[model samples]
Target: MHIKKAIERVPGGLMLIPLLLGACVHTFAPDAGKYFGSFTNGLMTGTVPILAVWFFCMGATINLKATGVVLKKSGTLVLTKILVAWVVAMIATRLLPPGGIQTGLFTGLSVLALVTAMDMTNGGLYAALMQQYGTQEEAGAFVLTSIESGPLVSMLILGATGVAVFEPRLFVGAVLPFLIGFALGNLDAELREFFGRCVHPLIPFFGFALGCSIDLGVIAKSGFTGVFVGLAVIVITGVPLILADKVIGGGNGTAGLAASSTAGAAVANPQIIGNMIPELKPMADSATAITATACLLTAILVPILTAMWARKYEMLRNKEQSAQAAPAQNPSSLAQDGHF
Candidate 1:
């Protein structure tokens, strides 16, 4: 069957499809995990362990030997993405209620949801888009942007902006696995490839585990609000990234637009962060639903926008090249035709 191809056709399918299936199990049979009480239960309730391994394998995939252009492009996008999310979180602290909006068209929306969705660039989506519409270096920029995959960046933004507090040790724990994997991978090329192969295969497993914590009703309640947050993520992160890409990274804005997405892995962050800070626990489920919606929305939109922008940029570039060559090819004809 073409089941794998079918899923690949959906935005964020490997992650989202499994996530929805897990959500179904949670919604319909909340006791299934305990009832099974074995490896099945472990798969049902293994978000943290699965994620830890995923992070480690993800780290192994980064070679640290990327060319200067790739690093510069990625660095610009990553920093810009985080900075924009931080700024939004800071502003949101004052504008939105601490617990989030309690009523109205924006019901169930929270600062945690906004920041989580905004902070992480969907590296898989961006890499795929860039592969089609950008330079090879731009496609490779996902190597660095992958750093935004876990909850660490969200924790940093929330902590720095006073939206939440986290102990110093929590910060260390968050990145230790990834850092160790990175060191080992750099030390031995074979180990890097071995661990790297595990990265994609692990997505659905963790996605399912993460979804087991969510209720579909929450997703239904927050559907519209989630779509809004997804749009905000793209616009809020997209503009600065584009400017930074052009001015500093020496490229058109396509890469920046491509990077303005919510990572499918980001769907787990609010839940993870909420567990770290008990005060934030109440909103985690709703935040996950909202962030999941945002992940799907941006995965679809960013590519279309990036492709349009790339084609336009290419056409203009070609037109300019033709214009520049006109004088060299036929100056006499131009003068005779009253063009000079």
Candidate 2:
């Protein structure tokens, strides 16, 4: 068992290590998230290289023929992801602690804006979701469409609500993932495959970095108070999505991608959080870090837990589906159905 191979299998799982390491540096010797943070020039450089490689692997995963359908569905899902997020944000705000989260709505707006500002069309997570649901074909086109469209539609509606922030730089970050995938697509297969292999290893390194940042201290500040807050946000962010998926999806569909909420929608997220609670920043940085860690954990944990719950839902739904279809199978059954 190559330890390296095992690491890639659990991509986000390992982020705890890095985040912990970062925190340790901050704690022990102190002054850490600074030096290495300098190279974190996600701005000019963009995560294009990493994004490109992930896209390439994603490309390799798909049925080349289905690419067209994937693109169409992706555009639609982007809109859906946005709307779901924004709607969740609006609804969640009323329940928030008020003063709008610190005498302003920063926490409410900034990051959650990015949270709601998504689209599933680009990120590798969508690819992962597609994998979980059997295949692009099995999940059907429209269901996947909603997941991708979620973020786009969220932004549109919220923008209409008169909530705005100034972050032109983030706009670039916002689109970078999709652009990374697109740029890589223009490449030939051999090159793409090579890049994918090369970058895949480094991918989990982020996870390790993410983990190191964690301190039992962050957890303590948050304590049950923070836990409840984070959990509230998670529940706020995910429940409606579950209903929508159950109603429209094929058993285990969008539930698979719930992790996206946890992954850090940093780009447009800050804006959304700000709109609802402007003063969220001072506390937000800490909250967001803790939340990001918690959210990512839930992204995986929720789906797995929900998948179990979904089995029951699916059984109930399937039982009904079967009962309904049974009548069509035979005239005697139709008569029997009416008797019940």
Candidate 3:
């Protein structure tokens, strides 16, 4: 059936397809995962281990000698995304109740969901868009953005904003895998290549595991609200990113637009946070569902917006070049006419 090709046809489909399949199983045939015994159950439920390995492999793929330009570009986007989310969370805190605001349209719109959806950009989507519309260094920028895939940044924003408190060890444990892999990768090229090759194939594995935790019913309930949150994330985070990319990254705003989407890995953050804070458990399910919807919406929208911006930028640059060359060409024509 050429499943890979089919999935590739959809935006973020490689991860999204397996994730939806997992969600279906969890929704319609929840017992199948449990009945299949340890391996299947573990495959469905063991997202942490799968994500740990994915993070390690992801880190290994990053080049240690990445230029300062790439780091700056990536860092600008990352910091902008986190800052936007943090600001949104702080504002939400002031506006909403401690339990969170629940209107008729949206059931579980909280600081957790807002920050989780806004903080992380879809690295795969950004890489793909940049590859098509940007330079090599811009595409390589995903190396830094990938670091935002886990919960550490969200936890930090939450903690820093005084919304949540976490232990020192929790922060360390969250980043340990990526740090270990980054260190090994920098120390040895061969080891980096060896682990780097394993990254792509592991995506669907963890994607499905993440989906297993989501209930489609929650997604249905959050329908319109989820869409609103997704668009909100794009506009809220995208504007600052565009400015940052232009000023710091020295590019047209495509990189910033590219960074607007939510990370698929973000779907796991609510559950992870809930595990640490028991009081948050009730909100986790709804948050995951909402984040998943946001991921889908952003994945579909960011590529289109990036492509349009790139095309417009190219057209403008061409016009400027033609305008500059016209005067030079006219002077040569005038000289030829004088000789005639």
In order of TM-score, best first, we have 1, 3, 2
Per-candidate RMSD vs. true structure? 1.9, 7.5, 2.3
Backbone collision tally, model 1: 0
**Alpha-carbon RMSD, candidate 3:** 2.3
- Supply every candidate's count of residue pairs whose N, Cα or C atoms clash at under 3 angstroms: 0, 75, 0
Please give, for residues 1-340, the per-residue lDDT of candidate 1 as tens digits.
9998999999999999999999999999999999999999999999999999999998888888989989989999999999999999999989999998767888779989999999999888888888888889999998898788799999999999888999999999999999999999999999999999999999999999988888899899899999999999989899999999999988899999999999999999999999999999998998999999999999889888898899999999999999988756478878999988
Give the candidate number with the greatest lDDT. Answer: 1
Ranking by lDDT: 1, 3, 2
lDDT of 2 at 13: 39
Score each candidate by Cα lDDT: 0.92, 0.43, 0.87
State the lDDT of candidate 3 residue by residue for 54-163, as single tens digits. 88877777776989988988988998898899899889878866666566776788888898999999988899899999999999898888778788898998888777
Candidate 2 least-lDDT 10 residues: 143-152
